[model samples]
Target: MKIFVLFAFAAFAVVVFSGRSEVSQANGRYSTGSIDAPTGVRSTVNLYATKVGVYWDTVRGATLYRIYRNTANDANTATDVGTSAGNYYFDLTAVAGQSYFYWVRAENSVTSSSFSEPASGRRANGNVFPGPFPPLDPPPSPSGNSVTAAKASLGKALFWDEQLSSTNTVACGTCHRPEAGGRDPRTLFGDLASRNPGPDGTPDTFDDIFGSPGVPKNNADGTYFDSPLFAYRPQVTKRRAPSYLNTGYSPNGLFWDGRATGEFRDPLTNEVLIAAGASLESQVLGPPVSDIEMAHGGRDWTQVAAKIAAVRPLMLAEDVPGSLRNWIGGRSYPELFEEAFGTPEVTPARIAMAIATHERQLFSDQTPLDRWGASIEQLTPQEMNGLSLFVNKRCIDCHTGSLLADNEFHNIGVRPQLEDRGRGAISNNPVDDGAFKTPTLRNVELRGPYMRNGQFQ
Candidate 1:
C-alpha cells in the first residue's frame, strides 16, 4: 500500500514538470519565472566643451540602461534622457555653465531596477571651471583696458620711464624691480618707521602706527627733503612693494589697503573711463604722482603726462633686455602713442591704460605647485606633506579660490585695531578696523619681505 502511494506521487510530479515544459515550448521562450533585479549600478558624468559624457557600471541582466538628468539635487523631477546598451550615454543638450545632476537605472524586457547614486557635474572650460569653487563662465578675459600688442608695448616703455617721476631718477621699475619678482630690492630704511594715514590723512595717530614704515617725509611743496636726523639715510618707503606677478588676475582692488579701488576715474579730469572692473587701471594712476613713492606730493597727473609726452620712452633704463628694447626701443613716446591709441597723444587715461595692459602680461603659473595642481608633474613627499598640512590646518580657507586669494578682508590677529585701520578707512566699519586682504601665495617664496609693513622678513 505504501509503494502504491509513492508511485502515484511520483506520477503527479512528472505531469506537473511536463506541463511546464510544454508551455515553454509553445511560447518558444524559457521564462526564469521572474528576472532578478539588476544590482551594483554606478554612474559618472564628465563635463566637456560641447557635451557631457556619462557612463555607468554594467548590470548582469540589463539589456539597456536609462539615464535620468536633473538640474537640481532633487531627483523627483528628473527626466529620462535616453537609454544605452553598453552603460554609457553622451548628453548633447548639456548647457554650458549650468550645474547638472545625473543618475542611471538598468532596464530589461521584464523589469527595471532602482537608480544608482546621483552625480553632479558642470560644463565649462576646465581652465576656468576649477573645482572647490564655482564655474567661471565667459571665462576670465582682459578688461576693457585689456592688453593688446601695441598697448602692452607702450605700457612696458612707460613702466621703465624715469621721467614719469618728479626726481627724474625714480621710475616704476625703481621699486618694482622685474628681476626681483617685481618687488623692491632695497630695505630702504632697515626696518624704518611709518604709519597709515588716519581719517584726516595724517599718519600721526595711534591707529596708524602699525602700517608701512617711514616713507621719506615730503616737503610742503611735494619735494624730497633731506631728513633732519640723517641726510645719508636712503629714502624710506611707507610700505613694502608687492610683487606684480599674477596681479592681472585680481578683479576688485589693488594695494594692501585696496585704496586703488575699482572706480576708473581719469586722474586729470576725474571723468569715469572704464567705470568699473579696472582695478589695475586705477592702481597705475597712483604711484606716478604719489609724493613719497614716485613723484612730488602735489604733482598732478597733468605734469606727469607732460613729462612723459615730451621725453623719450625708457631713455634711462640701461638694464632693459635687448629683446624688449628691440620691440619698443626705437619709437619716440609720441610715435608709440600713435601706434597704440590711433593718435600721438599721451593723456593720463592713455598712460594708465598702457601701464595696466603691460602689467597684465607679468603672470607666473609655472611654479612647482602650479604644475602639480595642473597635473603636469608630481610633488615630492616633503611638498606633499606640507600641502597636506596646509589643508589640514585650514590655511586654504582664506588663501583659496582660483587666484589663491580670498581678496576679502580678515583680521587674523596680526595687529590691534588701534594699530592699523586697514579696510576700516575705506569701509568705515569698526569690525573691519584691522582687517587686511589676504595676499596670494603663488611664487611667494621669490617675493619676500612679506607683509604690508615688511615685518615678516
Candidate 2:
C-alpha cells in the first residue's frame, strides 16, 4: 500500500507539470504588438465632396506601409500603394477629380501586420500639403504689363531655338526647359553636356548673329565675346541648373552666384558691370555664345563667322506677317521671339528681356495651405494645422513662398569635401564664407536629389 501511494503521487505530479509546459508553448514566448507613433501627424483631411486624404498613424519602426484605396468609381481605382517608410501618407489614389476610400497597413519585414484599422479618405479640392515654408509676399505684378499672346509664344520659340547659341546647336531651353522642372540636369535633360562646351569660355560669343548680317562683332560693334572657348568638362561645373520656374520673384539677378558668369565683370568693382554692358537682361543672352556651352571653333568668333551672320536673320522683322522675310531659314525666329517677349522685335537685349519676362509669370498657388492662407478657398483642419507647424517651426525664416527662396546664399552643409572658399571667392568678404544661393522650394516634393550636390534622399 505505501509503495502504491508513493508511485501514484509521483505520476500525478509529472502529468500536471507537463500539461503546464504544453500550455506555455502554445502561447509562444516573449511578447509582440504594434509600435507607437514616432512623429506627430495631423488629423486626416476632410474634403469638399466625399473625398478625404488618408495618412498613416504611427511611423514607429516600420519601413513601409502598403496602402489600398477604393471607391464606387471603378475596379481599376482600387490597387496596392506603397508609402516611403517615413512619410505620413501616399498619394496613391487613381481616382482623379473623384472621391476615394483608403486602407493602409504597416510592415517591417516583407510580411508585417495589417493596418491598425481600415481608415477612410478622399482627396479634397486642392493641391497636396506643401512642405514647411514661410509666407511669401505677393508676387510682383506682371512687370510692365500682361505679356501678350504673341510675345509669350515668341519667347518660347527663342527659348528652344539652338541658333541662339554660338554652336548653332543649343538654346535657352537647353538649360532651362519648362518640362524639366524648369531647369536642366546634365544626364537627365537630353545629355547636352556630351554635345556642348563649357558655359564660360570666350569662344562662346563668336557665332555670327543668326539673323543679323555682319562679321561676328567684336568689342567694337556692340558685341561682347572674343576669347578662348572652354571645352565641356563636368569636373568643373559641380552644380547644374536650378529651375527657372518662378524667376521673376527674384529681386536679384540670375544664376546661382547672383551675377551672370561669362559676361565681363567690372575690371574695377566686379559688381557685374551693366553700364555699357548687359543688364541682367543682356547677360541672359551670353550663354548661347559660349564655346563650351554653345560656341564653336575653339572660341574663335572669327572662325564661326558664317554661323554668326546666320543669327542676325533669325529674329529679323518680316515685311509679311506670317512669312520669313530676311532670315529665310526654313523656320522663323522673329515670329516666335515676338510671342514670348511681348514683341517680335529680336535683338540681344530684347531676347534677354523676353526670357526675363516669361520667367516672371510662372505662378501656381494651388496647394492645400493656399486654401486657408493664399488661395480663395478655405483650408481643412489638417492643412491649417500643418501651416501652424510650418510657421511655428520657423521654416519661414529662409523659405518664403509661392517662389520659396530669399535669393540669398547660405552654406547649408553641401559638398563639404570640396576645397577652396565658396561665396567668399566671389565676394572676397570674410562674412561670405561658404554661402550658396538659397533654393526656392516651390514644387519641391517633385524635385528631389535634394541638396546642391545632387544627393537624393
Candidate 3:
C-alpha cells in the first residue's frame, strides 16, 4: 500500500509540472497588447523664430513616438517629420507667418497605435526671412521692367545720343563712361571753381553738396563746357560716380545718399507714374534733367524726346559698335521708334524704359569668385585664404548676399569736413546721419577710385 502511494504522488507531480510548461508556451515568452495612442497632444512655439515644440501625455506602454507634420489641417497630407522616445518633440524647420499641424502616434515593439488628435502652432510675426540671391542667368525681367531685344536696341542708341544734352555734347555715355568703369573720368563736375558756396560762402558746411562739386558752369553761349582748363583749383566731386554694371539688381533707391528713390512719379503731375519695381526706370529719368549730368536747367522730357526724335540716331557718336550700327541701319529716329514701339511716337517713359532694358543686359557675373561658386573652377589657396579673412574680419556682415552687397545702410565713420549727411538727407532721421547704402563688390577690381567721395585708392 505504501509503494502504491509513492508512485501515484510521482505521477501527479509530473503531470502538474508538464501542464505548467504548456501554459507558458501557449502565452508566448514576452508579449503585450497594442500600444495606446498618445493623448492631450498640444503644440507651442518657443522664443526661437523657426522652432515648433510638440508635447503629449505619455502612453502606458509606448517605447517611442512618431511625430507627423502637415502644412494643412488634413491628415491625408501628413508626413512623419521625425521620431522621439520622450513625450516632447521639437521641430526646427518651422517658418514664421506659417501655421504647422502635427499629430503623434505611440509606437512599441508589438504595434503602433492610432495617431493622436492634430495640434497646431504658429511662429510669431516680424521674423525677416532671407531671400535668394542673384540667379545664374540674367533676370529676363524685373518686377515692373520687362526686357526685349528691340527695346534694348533703342535704349542703346538713346544712351549714347549726345542730343539728350543741351549743348549736344554730353550723353548718358559721357558721365556713365563705359570705358571708365561706367562712370565719368572727370574729377569735378566740369572745371575748377565749381564748389557750392555754403551759407557762409565757405568750402565746408551742412548745405554743401554731398558728392558733387557743383552744377556744371554754362559758357557765355549758355552751353556747358565739356572740359576747360580752369585757372583756379576746382572743387572735386562730393562723391564719385557709381558704376552701372549689375546695378539693375538694386530693387530700391539709387545714388550714394539714396535720394533718387525707386518710386516712379510724373514730373508734370504728382501721380505715381509706373508700376511697382520701376526703380531703374525712375532713376533713368532723374539724371537727364539734373544740371550736372546731361541737361541744362528747365530742360523737360518733352524737349529731350523731341530733340532725339528729330535728329538721326547716334549722329554725334564718334564710333558705334557694328551690332549697334546694324540695329540702326541708317534709319531715322522715327523709323527706329516704329520698330521698337508699335508707333513712331517717342515718349520720355519709352526712353527711360529702353535705357533701363539695355542697362539690365550689362551683367557682370563671370568673375573668378562667381566661377568658384559654379564649381567650374577651383579658387587658388591664396584667394580662399583672402575670402576666409574677409568673413573673419566681419566685412561680410554688410557685404553679404550674392551681389556681395547687403543693400542696407551703415555709418562707417567716413565723414568728410563738409559732413555730407547720406540717408539722413533722404529720411530726415538723425539716426541715419552719415549712413550710406552698401555698394556691390562684384567687379571691384575693375572699379577703382573707390569710396563715396573717391577718397581711397
Candidate 4:
C-alpha cells in the first residue's frame, strides 16, 4: 500500500511540472520565461515645465516599458499613463505645481512583469526665490514718448486692429498674445509648415528652425504672390518670436539679434525720432512695412500711415476689452490719433511712440515668486531645491537681477554657429556667432517652444 501511494504522488508531480512548462511556452515568442520587473525606478520634475520624467533600470529582455502614474503612493491604484521602448518616459500631461507618484513595468511579447516600486516627484511651482526681491529700475522711455493714458489707449487699439495689416487679417497682437506670455502660439505646432530651414536651406535637418508665420507674400498692387519657399502660404521668420513680456525692463536693444537698437530712426526721412532708450520704438516700426510680416512688397511708411488714416480704430477686432471699448465710444481713427498725439495726423513716429507707451504698461511683477518675496506666500520643498540648483548651477550668471535676465547675448550652442549668426549678423562680428539674447524667465512656463530656434518645448 505504501509503494502504491509513492508512485501516485510521483505521477501527480510530473503532471503539475508538465502543465507549468506548457503554460510558459503558450506564447511562442517567449518560450523561455516571463519578463522581469524593472528596478531602480526614479522620477524627476520640471526638467521641462509641468513634465514628470520617470526612469528605471532596463530589464534584459524588455521589448517595451509601461509607465504608470498616480496621485497617491499606492502602486496598485496607479493607472498606465504611457509606454516607451526605452527606459525613460516624460509625462507631459502632468499638472504644474502638483505631486505625482510613478511606477514602471517591463513587458515582452508574452507578458508584463510586476509593477516597480513607487517613486514620487513634483513639478516646481516656480514660486521660490532665494532672497528678497530687488528694487526694480524705472523702465526706459524715449525723451518725447512718456507713457500717457491717451497715447496708450490709442496704441492698444492699433495693436489689436487687424486692419493695420494689408490683408486685414494680422495684427501685432496676433503673434504676441497675452495668454501665451507674449509669444507666437503657432510655433507650438511642431510641424513642417511652421519650420524654417536654417542657413542650410534644407527641411527636416538638424538646423531646422521653429518660427512664427507672418503674412503671405503680396505684390505691390495688393495681389498675392507665390513664394519660392512657402508657395502661397505665409512667410515665416528665421528665428522664433521673442516674448514681448517684461521687454519694458530691457535696458539695451530688443529682438533676438538686437537689430532694433536704442536709437529710433525714421524709416523714410532719415531723421532721428527717439535718440536714446527707444529700443521699443525701433522694434515696433519694423513689422508694419516688412513684406514678410504685415505689408505688401515695397510698402513704405506713407502707405501704412495712409491706411491707418482711412480705417476705423480696431474695426476688425472682436470681444474688445470693456475698458478700451468704453474709452473708444464710437470714435474714428483720426479722433483717436488727435487725442493721442495732440493732432489728427498718424505719422510713423506717433505710431511707434503710442505703441511703445502701451507696451510699457505690460509689467508682470505680481507672480507667485513676487508674492513669496513679499512674505505673502511660501514655496514647496521641491521648489526650494530647484532654487538651490538654479544658483549652484550658475544659471544666475547669465540670468541675473529682478528681471531674471542680464539683457545680454549668449551662445549656449542650441545649434552650430553657422546655422544662425544671431547677434553676429547684427554686430558684424565673428565672436558673436550663434549668440542670441537672454530672454526673461518671468512667465516662462507660458512661453513654450523655448530658445531662439524654438527647438525645446
- Clashes (N, CA, C under 3 Å) per candidate: 4, 47, 4, 0
The candidate maximizing TM-score is 4
Scored by Cα lDDT, where does model 2 land?
Answer: 0.41
Query: Which of candidates 2 and 3 reaches a greater lDDT?
Result: 3
- Give the Cα RMSD of candidate 3: 28.6
Ranking by lDDT: 4, 3, 1, 2
Please provide, for model 3 over 276-317, each residue's C-alpha lDDT reduced to its tens digit, 9 standing for 90 to 100.
556667778876776555566677888778887889898878
lDDT of 2 at 396: 61
How well does each candidate superpose onto the true structure, as a TM-score?
A: 0.64, 0.48, 0.62, 0.70
Q: lDDT tens string, model 1, 1-457?
A: 4333322221111111111101000001112243223222322223345456565433433456678889987767898888765334567677766778888776657777666678776554333325432221121323467544456657777887777877676777667755555676664323333333433345444323222222354543545566543252334454567767567766658887787877788887788888666788889988877766666557788888888888877787786654345445366788778756769988999998888776765544324443344343455655655555656667679867545678888887755665667788888989888787788765454555667665554
lDDT of 2 by residue, 1-457 (tens): 4333322221111111111111000001111354322221221343322223343333323445556666643324556664533223436344435555555554554345543434455444544345433223324433332333223333443555566555344566556544445555342322323222222232223210111011122332234454342122321133455666656555555555555532434332344433322223444554555533555433433323334334643343223222112112233455344323435544554555445444443443334333333222554444445445555656567766445467777776554422324566677786666567777665554343445434343
Residue 309, model 4: Cα distance from true site in angstroms: 0.5
Q: Mind sharing the TM-score for model 1?
A: 0.64
Rank by TM-score (best first): 4, 1, 3, 2
Off-target runs (Cα >4 Å) in candidate 1 are 1-143, 188-224, 228-234
Choose the strongest candidate by lDDT. Answer: 4
Give the 10-residue window scoring lowest on summed lDDT in candidate 1. Answer: 18-27
